[model samples]
Target: MHPDVAVDILKKAETSLVSYRDTGFADAQTSAKEICEEMNVEAALKQKRLRTTKRQFSYEAPDEPITDALKKMEFSFFNVVVDMAIESLRERTGMMSDVAKKFSVLISFSSELEKQAKDLCNTLTSGDHSDLNYDELIVEMQSFPKQWPKQNMTKLDLVFLEEKGLKEIYPNMWVALRIAVTTPVSVVSAERSFSKL
Candidate 1:
């Protein structure tokens, strides 16, 4: 899954746990109040409700299974899961500089992005493409998007560059983008395959 999606799932899980706890608490409180009223307890009156409230505020609700389940749950486990998810997200996509560079490359071709791309390519290739004019290639890239409808262009990856025109425009940057996006942060699949074997 994408790091953003993973983070969202983690947040939802945490929120759901809290919501469950709060709903259980509210239900228990309401039930206690109802029982007090049913028994015609004088302390159940609005002005003296606290005296009766103290009597009915037991955490162990024999009749309310949901409330009992909530009380039995170890809520700290939710915090642990949320923390692990956050850490995994950070490990996967915490390279802000790389993310920003890719964003600039995908959004719109410009001289600045070209320079950055060239810098990145040079670092990867040890200056083999140093003589290439990245800015001119970026200018060519600007026209490639016009071939497709505005709404059709969602993710700016190699799939969009499979067209012959785009391939000829900025082959170097396309290769770089493909490699960057395809690279996996974890080798869980490989590990699982080895284990199965």
Candidate 2:
């Protein structure tokens, strides 16, 4: 993976460092740049460890208790930090420092996944409509949710769909929308795209 992408992932992994909805995560652009650079090293180490089956126990004597050591390490520095962050996240209402710190990776992964999924789903659902009707399909895709069942959508899902321009057709309907964004048929289409692409 590119160093830029790795840095993006680390930025997301550091979710405990920023606020919800806030754009600026790091102190300065220079600091973010430095953090991204440092993340490259951490990402490399993580990937290396993942690729290798050799556990930490391999470094110790066979006579030592690996299970005990593992338990002891469970409450190590990293785990404590994570626990603290989770607690803070649970208590907060809006985006907290933790969520913002993870901005880059979260944004990157979400955008990529949504894009790929939408592309595949659209491709499969799209028929060989003539050029004259192509525009209608786009409009229908944008407005279809207006005619959908409402009342079961999550706040996050509502926020997301609104951002996608789909909610413009039925602004009030969003609160009552009981829509399942993807179906098994769409999932199969996505899988097929994965195979073809």
Candidate 3:
């Protein structure tokens, strides 16, 4: 962008910074300076020709005296900062359009590579059965119904474990268990936040 246009952008951005950040003139001035530096503008010209308003107090003008003073600083002007950054990025790479297309392609490829890696890992580890503790417990729980032991105590133990796992594994069921334990069988407290369940 031209230096004049860049200056305008900086001025607008400074106005934005004032409102958005609740910062003073010093902060806004610093922002303008930073923008100038980033754009590699000449140092002398980068020093903005800031206009300072002087109080012209008089008996004729007793109330509001500030005139031509910019009001309501807006942060929308910070788009200049974004534009400058994008320009720099384009310079480092080839062009803005080409760089954006390349970035999207890279992202797509990376996502596919990640999915492939996860699948490969799962396939390699599928049958290396170093039985996790939970795995063994799950097997025992599944087998109890088939065995159908004649003893009442053994059957009760299996039923208890199965119920415990159901209540613990699912969040909604766990909340329901808490309600069952705490209150008089009323469906008020735990019924919320369980729409999907």
Candidate 4:
């Protein structure tokens, strides 16, 4: 299942709890206490089943402990969320450091791209710019969250840098940003392709 779907399910479950708290049940005449008790039991059973299914599908090795598998699964889910946030250029609220670390991981995944990014950083730091200064571009990128009020810049923004006239202003930085946004980390499509093989 997609992580988005899982998140949706969890959100719905939370909303249901809120609704249950606000209005005990649809029928006011009925015994709300008994009904809630029964619903709680049912919810517990469903949660158990869901956990069992997740454990079964997340099997890593023959001798691997379930706790270890669960830990790995949690990390993978967190990584996916981080990747989605970074690609979409979401504000990420207070996760700037974490996002930057994940961005580093994503860039490091490709040695060629990592080399290019390093080269661009070097060129900028070496003061060899013909138009835009490297320090200025780095400052702009770092302060993007504050500069853009809505913080709605997406991967498409990086793709069409000329629309915002950013290419001419931050050429090297724009290229590196484009590469970061365009890199594909998810293997869902690749897995699907291999399924038919």
> What's the TM-score of each model vs. the native?
0.42, 0.18, 0.18, 0.28
Per-residue lDDT of candidate 2, residues 1-197 (tens digit):
22223334445645644442133322333464677788873311122222334557555554443343333344454356556665544444233322332222211223253343344334334376322222343343344544332443332344464777765554333322222221111123346454211
Where does candidate 1 stray beyond 4 Å? Answer: 1-76, 100-104, 126-136, 142-161, 185-197
- Model 4 lDDT vs. the true structure? 0.43
Clashing pairs in 1: none
**What RMSD does model 4 have?**
15.3
* Worst 10 contiguous positions by lDDT, candidate 1: 43-52
**Maximum-TM-score candidate:** 1
The residue-by-residue lDDT of candidate 3 on 1-197, one tens digit each, is: 22223334545654554454454434665777788899997433323344557767676754443332232122333445545554553343333233233222111233353343233233224466421233332333333343333332211232343464653443322232232223221123576444322
What tens digits encode model 1's per-residue C-alpha lDDT throughout 26-78? 56557877887899764332322222233456787644323333333334454
**Worst lDDT 10-window in candidate 2:** 178-187
Model 2 misplaced stretches (Cα beyond 4 Å): 1-14, 17-60, 63-134, 137-197
Error of 3 at 124 (Å): 43
lDDT of 3 at 172: 28
Q: Locate the minimum summed-lDDT window of 10 residues in model 4.
A: 42-51
Relative to the unseen true structure, what is the C-alpha lDDT of residue 110 in candidate 4, on a scale of 0 to 100?
Answer: 35
Q: Where does model 4 exceed 4 Å of error? A: 1-101, 104-149, 158-160, 188-197
Winner on TM-score (3 vs 4): 4
Ranking by TM-score: 1, 4, 2, 3
